[model samples]
Each structure stands twice: as structure tokens, then as C-alpha cells.
Target: MPVYKAPVEDTLFVLKDVLGIEKFNNLPGFADATGDMVDAIVGEAAKLAEEVLFPVNLSGDQEGCTRHDDGSVTTPKGFKEAYQTYREGGWIGLSVPEEFGGQGLPYVLHTAVGEYMSSANMALTMYPGLTSGAIAAILVHGSDEQKSTYLPKMVEGTWTGTMNLTEPHCGTDLGMLRTKAAPQPDGSYKISGQKIFISAGEHDMSENIIHLVLARIEGAPEGTKGISLFIVPKFILNADGTPGTRNGVSCGAIEHKMGIHGNATCVLNYDEATGYLIGAENKGLAAMFVMMNEARLGVGLQGLAISETAYQNAANYARERIQGRALTGPKAPDKKADPIIVHADIRRALLQMRAINEAGRAFSLYSALQSDIAHRSADPAERQKADDILSIMTPVLKGVMTDRGFENAVAAQQVYGGHGYIEEHGMSQYVRDARIAMIYEGANGVQAMDLVGRKLAANGGRAVMAVFKEIGDFCEENRADERLAPFTKALKKGLNDLQAATMWFMQNAMAKPDNAGAGATDYMHLFGLVIQGYMWGRTVKAVHALQDAGDSRTEFLANKLVTARFFMERLMPETALRKARIETGCDTVMALDAAAF
Candidate 1:
């Protein structure tokens, strides 16, 4: 069986040392997230992940989810029980507001521990993950009555939630959606439509499923402008706030997916279901995006989670699986042959995975901190800047992390050679699970287009420019420190490449839109390389600062320094290639005609 030990200490280092999360004590929840509290939370989360969730991962995947004749769904054995344990422990509402029966901790804390839970069991994690996103949308856009009716129970985890946006015909284009809502005399609406690929759509794990569905109100404008969001419950609530009448929604079928089988990806059919509108009429897309953006960030973290788990198993296998002798000599004379880890090639693969996972973790947490600041900071200027940074990081994080995440999972599998392909060893599961993150929560391609087409130019490019300045300032500030010179030097080069790519889009994409479309993916990656490099630079400074303060764990610090160096030396340079691809523009990409095939 695959084993996972959550990197609790490493997470602490990021939260406490690198990001200095305590400095934000003026923010609502930061004061409560003291060193001791943060440590205790993550440490407990590790126990739940390693001991509880991980033990059921392979079994959950193998058994999958089952749908009954009555439209009730049964998750794999132990899933319901595990979910109950998770709910009882209040894991679902770690960062939800106190008003809604949550702990009201900083969002970053929730994000930090989220990595562990996801790495342990991505499928199981989705159940609550989707709920968190729904809660966010409702919190932001729902009316007071809506919040009172839904937020508390959803936050408490008794009623899980799911986002229903994709219809049978529409995946990325909400304009093409046909789900319709008709107004009722009692201030409600009747929703009739079909939503496809709904994760956590229906299950026995929770009492009720709160689906945030996107539908067009009757007589509304056509396309996306007409779309409105609604709260379509599986079981209608009575006057006493208990589940009363059975609503007209049901799970029609379960999708036989490539991975995350434990999640009940469903075809949900709504036959004039009683619905309550969220936000204003014809503004559902804007409201649902509140959830979509949150889901996108969560999906990005899934990339890191899967990559981390895959790397752990692969590294362990490399240390034990005897294969070829090292080219240098027999490092293990007693063995039949030296372990695979003794070979430079295996070491290279392991280091790459390690470098990306660590930096990716830091990148994710840092972005989450920005979110906390954006939402909680006192000063308007500070909030705007932090929100800008968060906005800029969102697409890059989702696009680049999952893209690299899938690649790294494949790389990890390659390290295990043939054993990785077999199911028993469990590497294949990681690869399979990692695959979906790139495709869902707005496919990475769409994420890339969003970055270049919309995000880059939002508010006249304020967000992107602000990010560039932050990276540039970091590079300029640290380039002179001989100890930090290598990191800053490489990061500077990457920043330059990223800036040049942005300029390329400005100069070329406006005239020829396809130029942006052709090179958007590369530009997204270029931006990712720089941001992760910036993370490493910040990590190195923190490590050095800790060392100067007489902190122990010399070995751990040394390894971090080595990994950070590897990132700068090996991974950061990829920015140049991405920039080159972007500069090549749309000619060859768009030159092919419809008849070419």
C-alpha cells in the first residue's frame, strides 16, 4: 500500500517563517492562528490524512461510487464513515466565517492544510472541496435569507454542496447553456434542465445536496448575459428548517470516468425543481464565478497534492528497488546491485519532482495569504494590491500547477519504471487522478486564455504590472547578496522573460488575436516559472534567516537550500523557452487550413 506522511514541518516553515503569517494579526483570524495553534491544526490534519483518508484511497478508487434506483448514491465502502469523522472534526469549516458556525480562521490556514488532505485522497476531498466553493459563492452573493437558510448547515457539513454550471451541451461556454428557470407566485422558481459532470452531485455522505445551478430566467436575454444562478436542493426545506418534500432533482446516471472514481460524477436531471435565485437576475455567471474561481484555486492545489504524493511513493521505491549499479562504482556492495537512486538519472528525476513540489507548495500558500489580505486587510490600498496579486496568481496557479503537476506525476511514474504502470504499486492512480485537475475547473487551456486575453489586460494591466514589479523588486533587492545571488540571478532572467512575453502579447496580440491564442499556454507557463522562482528566492532567505537565529535541523535546511538551487538552475530557465514559443506568434499555428487534414 502507498504511504503518505504530510510535510507538517515544512508547511509550518512556509506559514511562520517564509510568509510571516503572524504579521497579519491585525486581520480578523490571524491573531488566533498563533504558532502553537497553527502547529496543532496542521499536525492534527496530518493524522487525519495519513491515518484515516489515505488508508481508504486505493479501496475507494477500486470500489468507486454506486447509484441506486431511487437516485441515491452510495460512495465506496468506508467513505461515508470517513466523511462523518471528517465532519465531526469540523474539517470542512476550518476557514468559514464564525457567523456560519465555522472556526473563522485565516483562509491561508485552510489552504495550507488542504494540501495534505488532497494528497491523501483527492476523490474524497472533492466532496467537501465543492462544498467550500459553494459556501463562498453564497456568502458573497446570497441574500440574508439565503445565508440564514443555507450557510450554517453547509458550513457545518451536514449538507454538502455542489456547483452545477455545465450542461449537456455547454462545457466552457456558459452562453450555450439551456437550463431554464420559470418564476413562481410564491417568490420561487421552477428549474428544469440537465447538468453533466457534476462532482459530488449526489451521495449518502450528507443529508442534503445543495446544488448551485446556473439557469436562464424565462424571457431573459439570450446567451451568458441571461444566465442566473439558483439554489436547487435535492430535498426541499419545511417551515421548521428540516428537509421536507422531495424536490424534483435526481441523479440520472454516474459517469464512468478516467479517474477520481470515488467521487460521484453525475448526470443530474432537474424536472421543474423548486429553486431560489442567488444574486440578481441575469447575473448568475458572475455569482457562479465566485465559486468557479475558488474551485480553480482548489484544483491548482490538487495538482500540488497529487504531485507530492506521487513523488513520495516514487522516492521511497527508488531507495529500495535494486536495479543497475552506479556508474561511479558499487555504492551498495552487499546488494545484488545498487539501488536505482544511486544512478544520476534517477536522482535527476527525483530532484525535479522534489523541487517543483516544494516550490509549488510555497507558491500556493503565498497566494492564499494574498487572498487573506485581500479579504481582510484594513487599508483599501492594501486590499486592492493584494486582490490584484491574487487575481494574477489565480490563472497562473491553476494553469501552470496542474500542467506541471501532471507532468511531474508522469515523471514520478517513470522513476518506478514498469512497477509504476501496475495498479498494485499505486503510482498509476496518482497519474490518473492528476490527469483530471488539468481538464476540470476550467481546463488549463481556458485558464491560459483567461490569463492572456482577460487577466493581463484587466484594469489596464494593473494586476500583471504589479506582479512584475514585485518580482523585479525582489530580484533587485537580493541580487547583490552573494549567498542569494544564484537564485536572484536566475529569477531575474525569468522575470525578464515573463515581462518580454507580456510585452509581446501587447504589441502583437492586439493586432492579431490568434497570436494571443497560439502563445497563451506558453505565456502562462512562463509566468508560472517566474512566480515559483520567486517563491524559491523567498524560501532561501527564510532558511538563511532561520539558520542565523540558531535554529536547529541543519540537514533539513541544507536540503531545502539544495532544492531551491536546483529549481533556479534547472527549472527557472524554462521561462526562456516559453518566451521563445510566445514570440514565435500565430503564423505557423494559424496557417493550417481546414483542408490540411
Candidate 2:
């Protein structure tokens, strides 16, 4: 069985030392996220993850979700119960609105709790995770009546949610979607469509499934401009708003996917399902984006969560499993060979994984803080600034984090040698589960293009510049700190590399669009490296502060310092290679004629 101990200590450190989350007391829920409150909340979340979810993870993978002849799906054993425990504990409403029957906590707290659940059982986590994102969309776009009718039950976890944007014909390009919504006399539409790859689409855990779907109204304009969002439920509500009659919706079939078998990815058939428009006509994409952004950030958290779990299991095996002798000599002379951790090569792999995981956590939490500010800050300027940062970083967070996160999973698997490949050892499951995050929530390639194409040019590049400016300012301020000089220096180098790539795209990609398309992925990765590098720099500052204050966590602090150094010295140099590839542009990429193949 795989082991999962939530990184509560690390989370607490980042919360207090790095983010200083308590200082945001002026914000509505910020005051409650005090040291004790955070500890109590996250500590309980950890137990739930470890005790309830973690045990079922491997079983969930093995048993998978079962789809019956009737099209109803049954989650793997223990998944439903785990979700019940989760909802009863008020986990679903951790950051939801108090008006919606929630605890009204800061979003950051929910994010931390999410990380624990994800690390423990990603497939099971999707049930509530998708609900949270759907709730975010309805809360933003829904009318007062709509909010009152849906938000309370969804918040309380009596109902779960799913986003149904993809059709048989399209995934990312909403313009090509063929789903249709026809207007009715009672101000509701009859939605008739088939949406594929709908996660949590037919799960039995919830009493009702609220689908935030995208479709075009009759005679609407062509392409994305005509797209509209609708609230469609599996069962229509009665006068008391309880689920009464079955709607014209059913799971045509659940997809046999590569991973995440515990969550039913369904092909949903809506034969004129009763639906209500949430936002304006021909404006579905705008409303859907609210859910998309929320889901994107959540996916980024998935990346880090998987990586953290993989690292923990791999590190445990390295210490306990007997392996080849150390390059220096056998440290465990009594045994036949030293543990693999003593080998420099093994150390290199483990250290790099640890370095990236640590920094990625910081980046994610910082982004979450920005989200909190954007959503809750009293000052419009503060909110806008935070929103700008969040907008630019969302794609970066999803794309780069998942890309490296999958790499980390593979690295963890490699640590176990042949045992990793076999199913019983459980490493293969991590790799399989981590792979979906990159493809969904907008694939990493689309993410990179968005970074270069839309986001870079959004608001005349204010958001991207805001992120760069923050990193630049951090690098400059810490340049002279003796303890942090190495990190600051390397971070500056990566920052320069990212800037050069951005500037190159500005000069070249505009003239030839393929230039941006060809190099988008590289630029995104390069940008991620610098952002994570800056995360390390900030973390070093925090750790050094603790060290100076006579804190007793000497070994922990030392390990963190080592990880920071590894990130700067050994890992930060990849920016150069990525920058070189970015400058090469689309010459060779588009050289081949269509007939050549």
C-alpha cells in the first residue's frame, strides 16, 4: 500500500513564515485563519485523508468505477463513504459563502485541505472538487433565485456538480460545439446535446448532479460568440425544490479512461433537458471561464499533490530497501549494501524532486493568496492587482506545474526500479493519475498558447508584467542577503531567461504566428522555472528568519536550505536550453510539406 502523510508542517510553515496569512485579518475570513485555526483545520483534514481516503486509493484503482446496464455508476468501494464523511465534516463548504450554508473560510484554507485529499486519493477527490468549481460559476453568474435554489445544497454537498463543455466534436474550441439549447415560454431552455468526458457525471454519491453546460441557443451567431451556459440538473426539482422527476438526461456510457477510474467520466446525453440560462445569451464562454479558472487552479494543486505523494513513497523506499553500495563505501556495513539514498545518483533524483515539489507548493499557496485578495479585498486596486497576477499565473500554474509534476511522478517510479512498473508497488498509479491533469483543464499546449497569445496581450500585458515585476522586485531586494545570494542570483538568471523569451516572442511571433505556436510549451516551462525559482528564494528568506529566531527546527531548516540550493545550482540552468529552443522559432517546425508524410 502507498503511504500518505499530509505535509501539514510544511503547509503551516508556508502559511506563517512565507505568506504571513494572519496579517490579512482585515479580510473577511482572514482573521479566522490564525495559527491555531489553521492547525486545527488542516490537522483534521490530514486525518480524513490519511485514515479514510488513502486506504481506498489503491483499491479504487484496482476495482475502478463500475457502470451498470442502467447507466448509473458506482464508485469504488469506500469512495461514497469517504465523500459522506467529507460532506458531514463540512469539507465541501470550507471556502464557500456563509449565505450558502458554508463556513465562509478563506480560499487558501480550502486549497490546503484540497492538497491533502488529492495527495491521498485523486480520483475520489474529483467528486467534490468539480462541485466546488461549478459552485464558483453559479455563484458568479446565477441570478438571486438561481443562487438560492442551487448554492445551498451544493455547498452542503447534498448535490455534486460537473462542467459539460466538451462535445463529441470539440474540446477546447467552444466555437465548434454542436450542443443546442432552444428557448421555451416559461423562460427555460430545452437542452439537447451530448457532452463527452464529463467527470463525476453519473456518480451515485450525490442526490442530484448540477451540470454547468455550454450550448448555443436557436439562431444564435456562429462560433464562440454564440455559446451560452445553462444550469441543467439530472432530476428536475419540485415546488419544494427537492428532486422530483427525472430530467431528459442520462449517462449514455462511461468512458474507459487511461486513469482516474474511480471517477466516472461519462458521455452525457441530454434530450431536451430542462435548463435555465445563467448569464446573457451568446455569452456562455464568459461565464464558463469563471469555472475554468477555478478548475485550472485546482488542477495545478493536483499536480503538486501527486508529486508530493510520489516523493514521499519514493523517499521511503530509498531509505528502507537495500540497494547497491555507496560510491564512497558501504554505510550500512552490517547489511549487504547501503541504502540507495547513499548513492549520489539516487540522491540527485530524489533531491531534484523534493526541490521542485517544495517550490511548487510555495508558488501554489502564494497564488491562492492572490486569489483571496482578488475575491475579498476591500480596495478595488488591491483586488485588481491580485486578479491580474492570478490571470497570468493560472495557465502557468496549470501547465508548468503539471508538466513537471508528471516528470516527478516518473522520477519517483524510476526510484523504485522494476518494482515501480508492477501494479502492486503502486507507483504506476501515480504516473497514470498525474497524466490527466496536463491534458484536462485545457491542455498544457493550449495553456502555453494562451500565455503567449491571449494572456500576454491581455490588458496590454499588464498581468504578465505584474508577475515579472513581482519576481524582479523580489530578486533585487534579496541580492545582498548573504544567506540567500545564491538563490537570488540564480533566480535573476532564470528571470532574465524568461524575459528574453517573452521579448523574442514579441519581436518574432507576431510576424509569424507559428513562431509562438512552435515555442509556446518551452516558454511556459521556462516561465514556470523562474516562478518556482523565486518561490525558493522567498522560502529561503522564511527559513533563515526562523533560524535567526533560535527555532529548534535545525535539521528541517537545513534540509530546506539544501533543497533551495539544489533548485538554484542544479535546476535553474534549464532556462538557457528552453530559451535557446524558443529563439529557434518555427522554421523547421513548419518546413515539411503536407505531402511529405
Candidate 3:
């Protein structure tokens, strides 16, 4: 069985030292988010994940989600009670606004909590995770009345929320969606559509499910411009804020997939469902983005979470699994053989997983911090800068973190050899679960295009330059620090590669439009590796600072430095291969004609 010991100490170090959780506590509306409060919240969350959720992860995959003939979807056994515990614990709305029934924690802290939840049971966690995204959409674009009607209950976990964007015919290409919303006699509209791959679309976990759906309104233009967002509830609410009549929404069926089977993926049928319009009539796609971005980041955290979980299990296995004798001879000659961890290759695999997981954790936290800065900063310019950087980095976090996360899981599983492929081992679940994150929330390919084509070009490349400047400033400040020497060098090389890739794409995109599409994915990953290298470099510097101050966390800090070195030496060099591919141009990818193959 896969083991999961919560990395609580490392998480605390990142929150308290690296991201300044204390400083966040002083921010408006977060006065109660002290170190003690954070510790208590993280500790409780870890316990639930490790004890309750982790135990069910294997069974969840084994049993999967069940679709009944009555059209009701049933998650695996224990999911209901587990969800209730999550709700009662106030985890569902940890980062939501205080006006609602949420705890209103900062995103940075929420990111840490999310990592723990996901690490334990990513499939089960999706029920609440998707609800958080739905809540975000309603809060951002819904009318005040809508917010009053939905926010509190959703935050309280009496009800849950979901994003309904995909359809039977349309997945990523929302422009082709045929879902329609027609005006009714009352203020609400009638929605008719068939949405597929809807995560948590229908479940027994909560009393009500509020779906943020996208459909074309009557007389709207063709394509994406004509699409709008609507609020479709599974059950209509009464004047007393209780579920009244059953809405027209129903789950046609549920999908049996490769992983995340603990979370229902429903085929929803909205046959003249009672719906309320959010934002303008034809601006639904834009409104849905608010939720999509949040979901994207959450998915990225899923990637990081599963990787960390896999690493923990694999590392523990390596320490105990006795195999062949070591190259230098068996350390336990009296025993049968040496542990697998005694071998250099096994050590390398474990280190690879550790380095990526640690860096990914820090990167996800940094993105969350930027989100807080964008939302809570006092100055307009500061907020704008935060927004710019966030817009650029969001895709990177989603695309790179998830891609690397899957790789890390595979590596960790590799450490187990034949046992990794066995169902009973539970290590393969990490790989299976991590795989979807890359394809969902906009495929990694789409993310790369957005990064290189749109975000990089935003404000004439100011966003990209700002990120580069921040890294440059950090290097200048820490150049003299002996502990940061290797990290700094790796970061600088990564930056150079990022800039060169950017220039190459921009210069060739006009001449060959396909060039951007062809090279976007590889380039996005290259950029992410470089950015993560910078984050690891900064982490090493921070750890060294803590050590110099005679802090008791020297061992922890030293481990972080060593992990940073591991990342620089083993992981970051993959960018060279990616850069070479990007430089090779679109000829290799697009060389063949339509019928050539």
C-alpha cells in the first residue's frame, strides 16, 4: 500500500517563512489567520486526508462511481460522510469571502490546504473543488440577489456548485456548443442542453447543486461571441432559502474513466431547466473564465499534490524494500540484501520526485500569493503588476506543474518496478489520477498557446519582462550568497532559454501561423522549468537566511537547499531538449501534406 505522511513541517516553513503568512494575517478581512490558526487548520486537514481520505483512495478506484438506472449518481461508499466532515470543518470555503459563511482565508493558505486534500484523495476532493469554482463564478459575476441566494449555502456546504462548459459535441471548442437558453415568462430562462464530462455535476454529497452553465441565448450571434452563462440549480430554492421544487436538470448518465472515479463525471440533461442569467446576455464565456482560471490553478495543485503523494509513498517503499546488493556492497550483510534506496539510480529517482514536488509546491503557493496581491493590494499600480504577472504565470502553473507532476508520479512508480503496476500497491493511482489534469481545464496545448500567443504579447510583452526583472533583482541580491551559487546559475540559464524561445515564436508566428501552435506546448514547458528553477533558487536563498539567523529549522532548511540543487542538476536541463525542438521550426510537425501519411 502507498504511504502518505503529511509534509506538514515543510508546508509550515513555506507558509511562515517563504510566503510570510504572518504578513497576510495583517491584511484586511484576514485578521484571524494567525500562525496558530493556520497550524490548526492545516493540522486538522492533514489528519482527515491522511486518515479518512487516504484510506479510501484505493477502494475509490476499485469501486469507482456508480450510475443508477434511476438517473441518480452515487459516489463510492464513505464519500458522503467524508464530504460532511469536510464541510463541517469549514474547508469548502476556506478562501471565500467572509460576507458569505466562509472562513475567508488567503489563497496562499488555501493552496496549501488544497495540496493536502488533493494528495490524499484527488477524486473525492473534486466534489468540493468544483463547487469552489462555481462559487467563484457566482461571486464574481452573479447579481447581488444571486449571491445572496446562493453564496452562503454554497459556502456552508449545504449546497455545492459545478462548471458546465463541455457538451457531447464540444469539449475545448466551446464555440461549437449547441446548448441554448431561451427567455421564459418569468425573469429566469429555460435551458436545454446536453453537457458531457461535467465533474461533480450530480452527486448525493450536498442538498443542492448549483451549476454555472454556458449556452447561446435566442437571437445571439454565432460562435463564442453569442454564448452566455446561466445559473441552473438542481433544485429550485424556496423563499426561506430551502430547496423547493426539483429543477428540470437531470443526470443522463455518468462516465467510467481511467481515474478520479470517486468524483462523478455526469452527462447532464438540462431540459427547459429554470436558469438565471449571469453578467450580460451574450457575455457568458467571459464570466465563465473567472471560474475557469480558478479551476485551472486548482488542477495544477492537483498535479503537484498527487506527485507529492507518490513521492512520499515511493520514498518510504525504497527505504524498506530489500533488493539486490549495493554497488559498494550490502550495508546489511547479515540480512538478505540492501535496501533499494542504497542504489544510486533509485536515489536519483526519489530525488527527482522530491525536487519537482517541492518546487511545484512553492510555485503553486507563489501563484496564490500573486492572486492575493492582485485582489487585495492597496495601490492600483501594484495590483495591475500583480495581475499582469498572474495572467502570464497562471497557464505556466497549470500546464507545467501538471505535466511535471505526472512525470514525477511515473518516476516514483518506476521506483517500485513491477509492484508499481499492481492495483494493490496504489502507486499507479497517482499516475492515473494525475493524467487528467493535463487534458482538462484547457489542455496543456491550449495553455501553451495562451502563454506564448496571448499573455506574452499582452501590453507589448511587459508581463514577461516584469517576471524577468524580478528574477534579475533576486539574483543580484543573492549573488554573493555561497549557498545560492548553483541555483542562481541554473535560473539564469533557464531565463535565457525562455527569452530566446519567446523571440523565436514572435518573429516566426506572423510568417508561419502554424509555428505558434506547433511550438507553443514545448515553449510553455520550457518557460515553466525556468520559472520553477528561479523559485527553487529563491527558496534556497530564504533557507540560507533562516540558517544564518541560527533558526532551529536548519535541518529542514538544509534539505530544501539540497532539493533545489537536485532540481537544478536533474530536472531543469530538460529545457535544453525542448529549446532545441522549438528552434527546429514547424517543418518537422507540419511537413506532411493532408494525405501524406
Show where candidate 2 strays beyond 4 Å: none
Instruction: Using lDDT, give the best candidate's number.
Output: 1
Which has the higher lDDT value, candidate number 2 or candidate number 3? Answer: 2
In candidate 1 the C-alpha lDDT for residue 101 amounts to 95
lDDT of 2 by residue, 1-597 (tens): 679999998998888888889889999988877789899999999999999999999999999987898888899999999999999999999998899998889998998889999999999999999999999999999999999999999999999999999988899888999999999999999999899999999988999999999999999999999999999998999999999999998998989888888889999999999999998999999999999999999999999999999999999999998878987788999999888889888889999889988888888998999999999999999999999999989999999889888999999999999999999999999999999999998999999999899999889889988888998999888777887888898999999999999999999988899999999999999989998998898899999999999999899899999899988899899999999999999999999998997
Residue 51 error for model 1, in Å? 0.9
Residue 372 displacement in candidate 2 (angstroms): 0.5
Give per-residue CA lDDT, model 1, range 177-243, as digits (tens).
9998999999999999999999999999988889999999999999889999999998999998988
1 or 3, greater by lDDT: 1
What's each prediction's TM-score? 0.99, 0.99, 0.98
Q: Which ten residues in a row have the lowest lDDT in candidate 3?
A: 21-30
When 1 and 2 are scored with lDDT, the better candidate is 1
Q: For candidate 3, report its TM-score.
A: 0.98
